[model samples]
Target chain A: MGGPDYAELCQLYARYAAALDAARWDEWPEFFVEDCLYKLIPRENHERGFPLATLMFESKGMLQDRVYGIRETLFHDPYYQRHVIGAPLIHAATAERITCEANYAVLRTKLSELPTVFSLGRYIDEVVVTDGGLKFASKLVVYDNELIANSIIYPI
Target chain B: MDGAEAVFPDEMTWPAGDVGRVPFLAYTNPEFHKAELERFFYRDHWCYVGLEAEIPEPGDFIRTAVGERSVIVVRDDEGAINVVENVCAHRGVQFCRERHGNRLDQGFTCPYHQWKYTLQGDLRGVPFLRGLKRDGQVQGGMPPDFKTSDHGLNKLKVATRGGVIFASFDPDVESLEDFLGPEMLGYFDRLFDGRMLKILGYNRQRIPGNWKLMQENIKDPYHPGLLHTWFVTFGLWRADNKSELKMDAHHRHAAMISTRGQAAAAAPAEVTQVSSFKASMQLNDARFLDIVPEPWWKGPTAVMMTLFPSVILQQQVNSVSTRHIQPRGHGAFDFVWTHFGFEDDDEAMTQRRLRQANLFGPAGFVSADDGEVIELSQMGFEQKPFHRTVAELGGRDAADSDHMITETLIRGMYGYWRKVMGL
Candidate 1:
C-alpha cells in the first residue's frame, strides 16, 4: 500500500537475511505466502530457458519440509552461513503487488577456518500485500557462478 | 585389522593381487593418475560427451573435455554428428571458447588469429592465404605445397545409443553395443528409451578428492544405507530391498539396481541397529518423496550405472541425470551433472521432476553427504599412502550378487583399473 514504502521493504529484506544467516530455518516459511514459489537456479539456466533449478519449492509446505529434513533427518557437516544482502531496487509496485530485485552474497565459515564466499546471486522477487503484511509470493535466486565448491548444505 | 603395520612404503607393491585390498597410493600418487589417463581415457575408453538432443539442429554444438584434452561435438550441414579436437590447427589455441553455440553460417573462426573451419572441422580459410595486400600475390603467404586438408582438426570415432553420445580417440575401438555388454545395454535402454529428452539444467561441482573416489562412491552399494541417513530415515532405500551389482565381463562397467516394495518383511537385527535408520522420522510434505513410475523401467526404482573411467547414469526416484566426471588432478575433480526429463512429460510430471531435483546435486539431500566423506577418505591417504583400503565385505573377488550389502562393485572397478594401468 502507498507505493510500497522503500524503507519498509529494505527492513523486511534485512530481517529475511538475518533469519537465514542465524540458521533460524524453522521461521523461513513465515516470510512467504501460503502458495509461494521458491527456486535457486543458475544464471545460465535462466538465460537458456531451462526449467531445472538447484532447489525448487512450489508451496510453503514444501519449504517447511526442507527445513525439517535438514534439521532432523539429513546428516551434513556443521557449518555457518552468513548472508549479506544489498539494497532492494523496486521495479514496480501497486497497492496489491510489488516487484523487486537485489544483489546478495553468502559466506561460509566451518570450524576454525576463515569465512569464504560460498555463493553470489541476485534475488528476483514478486511480493504481495497480504492480510498479514508484505510477503514474498515468488523468489527466484539466479546465481552467477557455475562451479559450486563441494556441497551447498545451507540455503543461500 | 592391523593399523600399526599398515604403513605406506616408498615402493608401491600389491603382494596379493586381491580385489579386497587396494593401495592408497592409487588415489594420492600423481604419477599413477597421469598413467591412468593415458592408458584408459586417451586410448580405449568410450567417454560420454553429450546428448543428441543438445545438437538437434545442424551447426548446433557443445564443447567438452576428455581427460585434459578439449573436444567439440557438432552437427554438420549434412546432419552428421562429428566429434573433433577443439585445438586450432594453425596456432594450437582452443578454437571453440563458448560452451555451446550454433555455427549456422560460416562455421567456427579462431578469435586468436583468423583460421577458419567448417562445422565438420575442415580447414576452410586463413586470414591471408596468398598475400596481405594483393589477391593473387604470393607475398607473406603459405608455401604452394601447404594443404588445408592436412590441417583439419583431429577427429575421433563417434557413436550414439539411446540418444546418448560417446566418442573415443582410438579410431578402431569396438562398437558401443559390444563395449556395453548385453546386461549394461538393457539398463541404458531402460533409462534412455528413444523418447525425446529435454534439458533441465546443470550442477557443476568441484570436489577436493580423487576422481576415482566419485566412481567408487557410486559403485559401493554398502554406504547408501549407512552414510546417507536421509535415504534410510525417509525409507527411500533399505538394506532389505531387492538389489544387485551387475558388472560387465571384464569388470570395467557396473550397474547398481535397487527396487522398492521388496524390503524384507523384517529387517535384520544388524540393519535395524544402524544409527541412521530411524523408522520414526517422517516428512511433513511427503510429495517430495513420491514416485511417478515409468512404464519402460520395470526392474528397480533406483539405478546408478557407471561406465568405466568416468561417466555415471543415475536415476534416483523421479529425478534423472548424467554425471560426467572430469579429473582436475590427483586430488581434485569436477562432477558435471546434466539433469534432464522426457520432452513429452506433462506439467505435473515436469514439476515432480523439478521438485525432486533436491535429491542429488552438489547440495542434494542425498548427495551432500558424499562430498565430505570422499574428501576425508582422500585425506587419510596423506599420512599413509601405502596403507590399503580393506574391501572384503562380501568376498575377495569382484562378482555380481543379488544382495545389496557388498563392496563387490568397488572391487570390480579396481579390478579393471589395475589391468588398464598394468599395475
Candidate 2:
C-alpha cells in the first residue's frame, strides 16, 4: 500500500486545470469522490472562521448541478479562464489518504478585453486513494483578493 | 475657465419629466456623480456602516466606508458603538489600514505621527505637545491655546436598531426611523426583528457600473423571470408569482415582495413564454432548493428592499443577506454581501441558508447575470451619453403595483433621483 507519488499528483492537477481551462465542465466532478466537499471562500472569512463561501458543493451531485448551471442555467458574457497552478506541497501522506496545498492564479479574458488576473488563491486539498488512482475528497479554494471584478462566471 | 464650473454646463437635460425615460448622463458624467455623493451619501441620509455583531466586544473595530469616504466602526470600552472618520486630524492622513481587528489596548494610533485617540475617537494623547527640550528651552510646540477636544476624529451620528448600525455625517439629518419612513420601516423591521444575528460570511465584488444600477437591479423585478434562468425554470421567482411593489413616500426606497408560486401549479403563459424557462430543467442535487419556510417570513418568500443609496436588505427564501452598495466614482461601485442568519437557528437551518446563498453574491447562480448585465449597460452608457433608456413598462407614471410586470420601482427611484439631484 502506497500513496500517490509527486508525479502522479502533478499529473492529476494538470489534467484538472486542462479540463477547466478548456471549459469541459462536465468532466469536473469525475476528479472527485462521490461524497466530496468543494468550497471557494475568501481569506478574510476563512481566517475569521466564517461559514460562508462563494461556492460550496458538499457532494459530487452538487458539483454536477453547478456544471449544469454553467451549461444550461446561468447566462453571462462567455469568457475563457486559464489556471496557473503551482507545485503541490505535500503536508502528510498515508496509504489511504494524502493532504497537500498549492498556489493558483486564474486569468480570465473576455472576448473584447485583454487577459486579467481574475482570481488569486491557493487550493488546500485532501486526496484519497480510489480505483481511479487519486481523487479529491475535499478541495478548498481560498482566494486572497478581497474584491472580485464584477462576477466570477467560471469556477476557480 | 475653471475646472469645476466647466463641467456643469446647461445642456444636460433629462429626457422626460415623468422619469419614465432616463438619460445616460446619470451614469456617465463625473460631475453628476460628485453631486450625488454630496446630496445622497454625505448629508441628510443614514448610510449603513456594519452590523453590531461585527463589533460586539469592546475595542473591536472594522474599517468600512460611507459612500467613498472611509470610516471606522468600533465598540468602545463602555459598550457603545462609535463611527469615526479614518482621516487623522493632524496632517489629514487616512490611517487604520486593517479591515478589522481588536485594538483594545492602544486605541487608534496614526503611524505617520503618534497621535492617539480613544476608542470613542476622542483625541487623548499627543506626543511632545510642549516640544522636546534640547537646550532646556521649549521649541516647535503647538500654540498654548490649542485644544485637544477640537482635534478629535470626526465622529458621526450613529443609530443602532435590531443589531444593525447606520451613521450619518450630517448633524442635522433626521432620525433613522423618520428617514426609513413608516412603510419601508415595516419591511426593515420584519427582516431585522431584534434577534441577535450570527454572521455567516461575506462576498465582495466591484461592479463596473453606476451604483444606482445596483439599486435598480433589485427594484426592477421584471428581470428575474426573464434574465435568471435558474429562477424562472425552477419556479423560484417568476413574474406570475403573487407579488407586490411598494415604495416609501419619497419613492427613494422600495420593497419588492413576492410569494413563491405553487410547485404543482400548471405553467401559465407568462412563464411558459419565457425563453429562460425550461420544463426539463432540474437540479441534480435537490438540497440546493431544500427551502424550509420560517415563521419570520410571514407570507412572502422573497422581499428585496432597496434602502436608498446605501444598502439593500435581501430575504430570498431561506437565504438572508445585506448587500451594501459603496459607490466609487460614476462608472463603478463595490457591492458587498454580508450573509447571515439568526443566532438561534438550528444546524440544519444554518446549512440550508448557506446552501441557498449559492443563488446570490458575485458567483451566484442568478445574481452573476445581474453583475454582467450592469457592466454591459455601463459600457453602452459611456459609448453614448446622449442616448436615453425607456422604463415605460407599466406606464409613464411611478406608483406601487400588485404585479411584477411593471417597471414602476425603477421609475419611482428615478423620480426621487431627479428631485434630489435637481437634474
Q: Best TM-score goes to which candidate? A: 2
Which lDDT tens digits does candidate 1 get at residues A18-112? 99989998889989998999888888888999888888888898888788767865566688888899999888889888899999999889887
Model 2: how far residue B221 lies from native, Å:
0.7
DockQ of each: 0.72, 0.84
Assess each prediction's global lDDT (C-alpha) against the native: 0.85, 0.90
Query: Which docking class does model 1 fall in?
Result: medium
* Tens digit of per-residue lDDT, candidate 1, span B224-338: 8887777776777778777888999989899999897633243555774566465665676777776788876685788899998779999987889999988998998888899
Model 1 DockQ reads 0.72
Tell me, by lDDT, which candidate is best: 2
Residue-level lDDT for A3 in candidate 1:
59
lDDT of 1: 0.85
Each model's RMSD to truth, in Å? 2.2, 3.1
TM-score of each: 0.95, 0.97
Clashing pairs in 1: B8-B386
